[model samples]
Target: MTSKFDHTVYTLRRARLASQLGAQGVAIIPTAPEQQRNRDSNFLYRHDSYFYYLTGFTEPNATLIIFADGRTVLFCQPKDVEREIWDGYRLGPESAVQVLGVTNAYSNVLIDTEMPKFLENIPTLWYPFSIHKGLSVQIDNWLTVVQSKVRSGVSAPHRLNDVCSLIDEMRLIKDSHEIELMRTAGRISANAHIRAMQFCSTNIRNKNQIFEYHLDAELLYEFRRCGSEFPAYSSIVASGSNACVLHYRADKASINDGELVLIDAGCEYSSYAGDITRTFPANGRFSRAQRALYDVVLESQYAAVSSTRSGALFTDPHNAALRVLCKGLLDLGILKADKCGSVDDVIANKDYFPFYMHRTSHWLGMDVHDCGAYSEPNSLAQNSAPSPRVLRTGMVLTIEPGLYIRPSADVPVEYHNMGIRIEDDALVGDSACELLTRDVPVDPIEIENLMN
Candidate 1:
């Protein structure tokens, strides 16, 4: 049942990166180190997204060294029979070259000895500073060693640059293989959201008179059943007024009658993330106030998702969704025209911060909030705003719009303590973007029917 890993894809990725770094340069990217969770137990190992992107090697204590002359050397842990009995398998050096599709592989013991020779006379050295403190010290030590050999005519690198920015740009655009993995991830995450809804609706909502952690358990069960490696982020299962607080993770509140539950959770499949959010009635049906608020948020989400195409500015989705949210709040009497002025005035002054605060979209891929620069580096005057980066084909992002109405003196009683958010994974295309997480129902009626 086991198939060989696609070694060709990783080799090609190195070739692309190598071309960017010329023959006179060298680049070193290392994977994440293991961290201890308790006294003796280590946290679950997950490879760095950037390291996994280039080498596709998941093992910790590994470093990838690539030269512009089409040479790649992977330094990793050597095989040990005694260690293997306690831990798992390791490809080692010899087997790593054959299976991992590297030009050469070596044990970690040789890194300090061999890396100095690789750095000699290389004009430009690329390293991600401010990232790994230990690696930074090691790189400085290597430069010092080469500098000490100046009497023997050995020259060290005079220029040190960051390779992380370039890799961040590269990861912004997902390839065909990455897109497929994310598509599978989105499907799995969507089904988990659906399962949470059904789990909340048992026994006419009597069996679901439980804590928010119970709902989180349902989500976890479905994610595992559908082959997801882990949740991309901590599951946010907020109920009633707790939903008004963003990034609420303490899932300990009780689900009361007429209150809605907001679950913002995602899963990682094949190392890519699938982000999704859904708000539904704790019971099978929505209350009048909940239904009205949900409709507005859903409409705003559609506006945002529609703006996710290529050639669109990165802020286009947020601007589009904000327009809809402003009008929705106005229509609901949450923001009176006389008190908050016209929609144009509210937008000009950013008067919607109280109700709809966060941005509408963000880049999505291996990490939940993936890498990439959001704006063009200030081509404007010092006091002016910079223009947003334009969206491109093959880029994946999230389109999320929400409205959170907490109790206030100005807020109407019916709209108080109600929070709603709708989110989906989007793949930018030639014209419009494709929805990857469309398996779950966004409509309240559709959710209620499925739960029933």
Candidate 2:
């Protein structure tokens, strides 16, 4: 099968990776292994992000080897007509060379026999040991074969390194292609939210009778219609008190007419993810207390997004949003002034955590919470790694601020069992951040109007 990718680009990536590895370094990466979903049934195959980053190959059971001399070698399954009739066509080695622009290709059956030769003479080996299970034993056995040959004057690689460290830096900053795919994903997700709102808005179905799965079904339908690989995460269709559960998956509850429904969901497009959360009234109009609480969460989200621009520290947005939420909770009397102290003291003591529990943002990309270290490199001499700082252009993240008010004595009765969260995906740019999910309406009135 031919790839849609510009094979030259992947070749260039391999070249860059090889140059970074130096002349004696060799790296081996593998696509994700196929997993059984049930008896005699397999889950959909997805290429490993790190492997696909280099090769763009989707077929399972493939391994990539990059040598320090800028050589990219692939070992993959060969074409089998019988297997293709059931599982799908395999990108045989010959086509991989032509389609993926690799230096060489061989059948996966030859890996055990041929990889020992490729491992010969290399000093540093780069592979993610913790990521792929059973990979360590495979490497150990392969090295044992190489170790036996030391008398022949060929030494196996002696040093080990995590490939993620090298690839994480590259993936942290979104390239033009990645950003475009994310943008498309955001569009599809935004529309799904709108469709959910419309489904709830239609008076033909009473809000009290609408099940959480009804809205979730709408999202699933929209996601597939728009060509998503899958949902970035399990869709959270939490209704009323269920909204306070955070990662709620049970979608059996009926949406009450006066209660708020929180839907936190996103779709993965082209292996990239778009995450968004929208909280709206089940009946399409917020009551007085709900309106006040929703505004506070929305304001906190805005504060967080404001700090998401380029050059801001990675922690800046979280801090900025926390301040807004703490103040909001204090003013609303959800947190007592005497007990919680001043807003500064409240933050210092983490008094705000009870109401607003989670951090405001996380890096978003190929994975929902994408790879990339939060901390910058530590100085070898001082050896202290400080908090992560500096958001550069091309970094994408989510700004989500939420307030969950479960029933409590101090919590106001009007707000009991209310949970509100607003989130959006933002891309750091030269001057500001672009709101990828901007198409989704956040204003209470707008949501009400759309629902009406």
* Cα deviation of 262, candidate 1, in Å: 0.4
Candidate 2 RMSD to the correct structure = 1.6
**Residue pairs with backbone atoms closer than 3 Å in model 1 (clashes):** none
State candidate 2's TM-score: 0.97
RMSD of 1: 1.9
Candidate 1 residue runs with Cα over 4 Å from true position: 1-3, 377-385
Global lDDT of model 1: 0.87
Query: Per-residue lDDT for 292-326 in model 1, tens only?
Result: 88998999888888887899998998999999999
User: Which runs in model 2 stand beyond 4 Å of their true positions?
Assistant: 1-3, 203-208, 379-382
Backbone N/Cα/C clashes per model: 0, 0
TM-score list, all predictions? 0.97, 0.97
